[model samples]
Target chain A: MWLYFLKRLGLAVAVVAIVIAALFAMIHAIPGDPARVALGPRASEELVAAFRERIGLDQPILVQMGNFYVSLLRGDLGRDAVSGEPVLRILLSQLPDTLYLVLGSILVAVVPGVFLGTLAARHRGSLIDRVTSVISVSVMSIPAFVIAIYLLLIFSIELQWFPAIGAGEGVLDRLHRLVLPSLALGLAWIGYVARILRASILEEMNEPHVRTARAFGLSENRIMYDYVLRIAILPTITVLGIGVGHMLSGAVFAEIVFARPGIGKLVFDAIISRNYPVVTGAVLLTTIFFVLVNLLADLVIAWLDPRVRHDLAG
Target chain B: MTRNTALSIRDLSISYDTPEGRLRAIREVSFDVARGGITGLVGESGCGKSTLMSAILGLLDGAAIVESGEIWLGETDLLTLSRGEMRRLLGDRIGAVFQDPMRSLNPVLTIGRQMTDIQFRHRLSRRTKRERAIEMLHKVRIPDPAARLDRYPHELSGGMRQRVAIAMALMAEPDLLVADEPTTALDATLEMRTIELLRELQQEIGCAIVFITHHLGVVSELCDDTVIMYAGEVVEAGPTRALFEAPRHPYTDLLFACDPARIRERSRHLPTIPGTVPGLIDVPPGCVFAERCPERFAPCGRLHPRPLRVRGSEAVRCHLHDPEVTS
Candidate 1:
């Protein structure tokens, strides 16, 4: 099992390396002058040229990539285009906010989503199942931005429940302001999770072990939780792992709509200003985070299901 | 001795609400299994044999509704107990071993955990439960119970898993054990070993066993009394020796004739029961086996025959077996 994980880790590292290279090349390939953008539109030609030389923009693309990789290995993510501050420092400061939002939304989505999904499966064709199905489908069908805008309008503009723009002062305050955006993101995910889990549970509930559990005189709750849910929810864990990256991407759009001072807004500003260093750092950090989350999920799945470990070992 | 009846059923009818409508699976099924005796419930597939077992165990699904019945296990009517009460009694006093041992045991749990869980449910101390689990495993004659306890269900072979399941069922020392086609999925040697294990366990535990199967050879070998069910009803029932020697019901006679051993002994072509068992949804009004019985008469198509006592020790549900009838 450890050997299999090591192999997977190797493959993941290769994939991430390829992704970083591609992202670096693509960002630089855009028809624009990074030095001109950095020095501002009003800067003299000499000033722009001097800025380009300082940043090694005149070097060959391969040489520049080599330099970037070397600096990346040394934990130096270059300088921000506008502030000339270390891009790594700025990213480290903003990392927590993105992590908080993504993790919170996932927690809010997974618990209730799985619970409702299991309930729907166990009482399939019942009124509760029908109602949950309709609600989840409706939530999923609507676009996230639309939900975010609607929530903003309701809570910020009309109800005066939360601030209209910017993350609030303290951690609790930031979380309070984040409630609408997280829900906006989580609403769509809850529907998807519930749908997947419902299908899985329905399939598992028909399995003979479930029948055996019932025959053993296990209560409905015990059988559902212990036998049915344990097996059925395995697929959901894998899906959740894959969905983490998507959720982070969604958080970008959500932050923009809510005007929260997080990584999403930082990325938007950097993209507009052509801050290549910040962009590269943000993308790399997100990729690494995703890979790490997936690795953790894999470990969790192995722990929950011994068969997976056996299969891996075999 | 009279008080030793472990399971007594009377006029039990079970039906399910399917898409087509209400379908009767078993009708007026009645039988009694005395304590410490193995009662073999024998029938072909779709003959309501399994339905009868599920009904008696109170394990029928949501769709099935018991129309009328009394499933008395000791002083308690199992049919009347609340789901909680039934659950408490089940696996403690009444154990069950299902067909397809691969599916019966929880794939995620170890054999030891499965056994100890039942013991735990009955509120046995953890240490005692653990010791009893190993003891039960030994009782099933599983080699190296201590080492095998840690192995998951998939690690063991099919026959070994079946033995583990049986051991788990007997962990609580239940008074009645239901073996539902316990050896059907096993090879011949494994099947014999499983039967031997069951008989030995029964001898040690002194438990009443309801062994449900289609194989008459198994019934002849292990059962003291046998009930031959046909199309949701008992067509013939009596002492195993008497019923096997002189099967009065034509369906029973045809079943015996169809056996390969019997056909070889008679040195004749195997007699096959013509036509399939009728669908439960539209069971015939008269005799369920009338369409398949070669000796069936016109009256067999119009009137359902009640089980009549024949020759003191046997009961045959046929017009021909009625003492008043001369035919």
Candidate 2:
């Protein structure tokens, strides 16, 4: 199993390198002069040229990419376009906000999602099950932005349950301000997790081991929660990691719709302004984070479910 | 229900609600598993053996309806017990091992955990439960029982998993143990060894076992009593030797005839019962095997013959064995 994780780690490293390379090439593919795009049209020609030279745009594309890779390896994210500060420092400032939002949304999705899923599976084919199915499907059918708009309309605009815009202050302030955005971002994923967990629970309940459990006279609660749920929760765990990774990379809708100062918003602002250093650093960090998270999820699942190790090893 | 019997299944009828319609799966099946003995419930595929076992364990799905029945374990009617009541009776008074040992034990759980988990019905400490688990594993002849405890089900071979399953089932020292074709997925040697293990365990534990299988050889070789099922009905039931020797039901006789050992001359084709068992959806009011029976007489086609008591504790549900109908 350790060997399996070792191989996965190797694979994740390759994936990170590949993602960084692809994003670098994609940035280079942008049609306009990045220096002019950064300094804007009114800036002096000499300033644009100086900016291009500073970013190594005069160098060959391969050399430029090699430079980026080297600097990335050395933990240098280069300078911000306007502030002349390290891109890494700016991202470090933004990381906690994004982490809080993303992780908080995951909690929002999972706690209710797993609870509803368990309830649905326990009372499958009943009125409660039907209601849960309808709710989850309806939520899943709507896109994140639309859900965001609706939540803002109800909770922010009308009810004033939470402030609509900006990622807020410190720990409690950020958590308080995050409530709506987290809901908007995670509502659909809650449906996804619920559906996955419900199907898994239903499947687990009918398994031969479950029958054996029932025959041994395990209480229905113990059978459902302990025996069945332990196995059923595996698929949900994998899905959760993927969802969290996606959200971390850019909960673009949530970050933008709420005008939050999250990593996603920072990346979005950088991309729009052609802040090459910030964009590359933010994208690379996000890719590495996503890959590492997925690797961790796989290892956790393999630990919990030995049957998964065969597939993991392969 | 009788004092000598560990499980008494009386006039039990069960059905399943399918998309097509409600289909009768078990039709008034009756039998008694005597204490400290193995009773083999033999039948072909889809003949309600599994359904009956599920009913006995109260593990049937929502679609399954026990239309009428009484499963008596001791003086208490299991059918009358609530879910909680049945649960309390499970590991303490009854145990079960299913077919496909690959699926019978939870793949994620250690053998030790599963073994101890079943003993949750007991008021013993965790240490006592672990000790009992090791003891049961040893009884099933699993090598290095203590070390094997930490191994998960997937780590064990099919035979070893089945052994672990048996050991786990017997930890509570249940009064009755239901083996539902537990050896069906094993190789011939493993199957033989498992049957021997069951026999030795039954003798030692003094627990009645209702061994459900389709293997005639298994029944004849190991079971003290045999019940032959046709479709969803019990066609013949008695002491294994008596039933094998003077099997009165035409279905039982035909089943024995279909065995490969009975064929003296070498042939390219093997003997088979000519027709398939009828679907339970629209059962006819006649012998379940009448369509396939060569000796099916006048009354066989028109009337359903109840099991006729031909000898002491022996019965056959065939017109040939029904003297009034035959006469």
**Highest DockQ model number:** 2
lDDT tens string, model 2, B195-219?
Answer: 9998888888899999999888988
Candidates in order have lDDT scores of 0.84, 0.87
Candidate 2 lDDT, A121-174, residue by residue in tens: 989899999999988998889988888898899998999989899877777777
Candidate 1: which stretches are off by over 4 Å? A28-31, A41-71, A168-170, B261-272, B323-326
Candidate 2, residue A271: Cα displacement in angstroms equals 2.1
User: Pairs clashing in candidate 1?
Assistant: none
The runs of at least 3 residues in candidate 2 whose Cα sits more than 4 Å from the true structure, single-residue gaps closed, are A310-314
The candidate 1 chain A region of ten consecutive residues with least summed lDDT is A209-218
Candidate 2, pairs of clashing residues? none
What does candidate 1 score on TM? 0.92
Cα error of candidate 1 at position B215, Å: 2.3
lDDT of 2: 0.87
